[model samples]
Target: MLYKVLEVPGIEYIVLDFKSSDGNFIAQDLDDSETWNAKAFYQWLIDEVLVFTDDGISGMDKDLYKQFKAFANQRGVCVCDSRKI
Candidate 1:
């Protein structure tokens, strides 16, 4: 399973060089965030993206996922755990 943390403006997320677990991380130019504008990214996250893993490990940890999903749901953030990837 691939796990990641996404930080908003005031928070700090995990950093990566190419691939990443941090939200808003750049795959190319580390500072070239303008290309990966957050609004569009978040929109895609809510509408299209999901916490999926190629090994079909997404949302496998049910208790934790459910707690986080509940938290996100309360805050109106999108957190999907409908099935395995």
Candidate 2:
């Protein structure tokens, strides 16, 4: 499964990009985007139009905890293991 992090204003989101059982590409924005597609998803994530999470993480489809831990390191966003929080 492909994964991405996004944010708009006061909200942060995690986007899960995957294929449906019917063989069609599907995108689900964790915080809810009814119009996002895989076509420009990467660009959106890279543009910094969305910021990384600094509080908590979402999206269980991917190993989001581990993924965000690394992401937080690079961006200086502190993230702790949920089990310990």
Candidate 1 per-residue lDDT, tens place, 1-85, comes to 1133242122233233434454333322235443333333433444454455543225345554455455445545565433432
lDDT score, candidate 1, position 51: 51
For model 1 the local lDDT of residue 23 reads 38
Worst 10 residues of 1 by lDDT: 1-10
Per-residue error (Å), model 2, residue 8: 17
lDDT of each: 0.40, 0.43
Model 2 bad stretches (over 4 Å): 4-17, 20-24, 49-85
List residue ranges in candidate 1 displaced over 4 A. Answer: 1-50, 53-60, 81-85
Superposed on all Cα atoms, the candidates' RMSDs to the truth, in angstroms, are 9.9, 10.3
Model 2: residue 19 alpha-carbon error in angstroms:
1.9
Candidate 2 lDDT over residue span 1-85, tens digit each: 2333433233345545455563334445565555455434433443434333444443332465467455444544444443354
Error of 2 at 1 (Å): 7.1
